[model samples]
Target: MKVNNSNLDFDSNATDSESERAAVAPVVCLENIHKQFGSLEVLKGIDLKASAGEVISLIGSSGSGKSTLLRCANLLEVPQDGEIIFEGEPIIWSGSGFSRKPSDNDQVRKLRTNLSMVFQQFNLWAHLTILENVIEAPVTVLGRDPLQSAAFGLELLEKVGIGDKSDAYPSQLSGGQQQRAAIARALAMEPRAILFDEPTSALDPELEAEVVRVIKSLADEGRTMIIVTHDMKLAREVANQSIFLHQGLIEEQGDPEELFGNPKSERLQQFLSATASV
Candidate 1:
């Protein structure tokens, strides 16, 4: 398989026939993206795309910029360089040389409502009931009708397999259950895509599968998703495509089967073999 830097843009219209091929329009496109924290450069010229309904898993060791890249996708972390187009609209860039003014609080809030994010720690409001936590943002932030938001929240909880936990508080639920509720909350907003950052990294093996199952179900239903994870097995099973980052740069990426089963990059091969050895 020949993996080159030429096809790194995330536009769905872009095409390349190297290893494995699939037909779909990319929902998320990143072109020449770069991020830095003072002197520390995290993401270096990242070009990637995800087709509608395609599941792309980001894998790399700690500090490889996987999480930073995911955050930039949803504008959670602003990039110093490059363009990010989500579902078609360019994410407002704040830094110099960008035409659009950086997104303000209100603009960013709206962007977030459309593109939901699920964190690893399951950032739920402990004081609120499961249902309330899910409905809070939609009603308070989006000004959605209370009744309609509640109904939607309930439906989402059920969809994520935790409808019965609506009345319980976060403290009352297990790690897996809490994560599921978080996912439901993200879904309630009806975002064009969901960004997951290490959703299952904190869970034990047994508990992890519950979250994985829900994610798999979402993929089956054709939900566009980008996940930053260390779980190679789950990535292999659920991801249609994969990206491997090394030292803050994309080392290799392609179909998960090709990347995992037969990686071409020396960095990727070394990383996989090391992971397997562990």
Candidate 2:
């Protein structure tokens, strides 16, 4: 397939068009993306485009490959086929066939730094304080001074509303606090975009709101984000657009209000109705 390169350009000159036209150029573009594990295909010819600073939510039932697609966006899982363009550059897929040339380890690391991921598990280091957890990556992997990294880390913690918990270890913090700290860590990398995989799924309802508030603030700041979430309310409120995935394929996608309030596909209508009841 000849991939369309027009949607990948993000130059300032391209921004002079009408607001809607400017918004159409994607900051993140995925075309013919396919992922499989053994014989089970996870993502089948998925195509998605997200504009600069847009929040695109991926929503679906469990096992619908929403999380898998998010992972593939950041190269956490090597898709068997497809092209992913981030920040105007095609993500060099290291896997076999049709994808771009294999990226070396150094190149892969650099690409990952541009795309940070926040997981549901809140994967913080047990021994490190919240501050340390956020600064460790910049200091070690990025090779910045620890003191400089710590300063930025604190700012990120404050941004996520967890600056007060900076000195506390992960074990000492509540689940919500820990997840906020994890988000801060991702922000500390100064990524071009963030990928979230069910960020609030592990939290209780009360705790979930706290993390969602931080995400809302990020969206308000115009940070590009791709969130894989089952929380329909969050999707409806936070997302500028929503994509409905069903059985590893995109069932329907459009403006959040249109997709949620008036779904176009029978599969999406059924999925939403079933989920709304639960």
Q: Which candidate number would show the highest TM-score if scored against the true structure?
A: 2
Ten contiguous residues with the weakest lDDT in model 2: 1-10
lDDT of 1 by residue, 1-278 (tens): 11222343443333444222344335678888888888899988998776556778999999999999988877877788888776556666554633334556665676678778899999899899999999998898888999999999999999888999999999999999999999999888888778899999989888899999999998888777889998999888888778999988889887788889999999899999999987
What is the lDDT, from 0 to 100, of the residue 177 in candidate 1?
A: 96
Query: Candidate 2: where is the Cα deviation over 4 Å?
Result: 1-25, 93-101
Residue 116 deviation, candidate 1, in Å? 1.0
Which residue pairs overlap in candidate 1's backbone? Answer: 8-47, 10-48, 10-49, 12-26, 26-51
lDDT of each: 0.82, 0.82
**Per-residue lDDT tens digits of candidate 2, residues 222-248?**
777889998999887788778899989
Residue 269, model 1: lDDT of 93
Model 1, residue 196: C-alpha shift (Å): 0.6
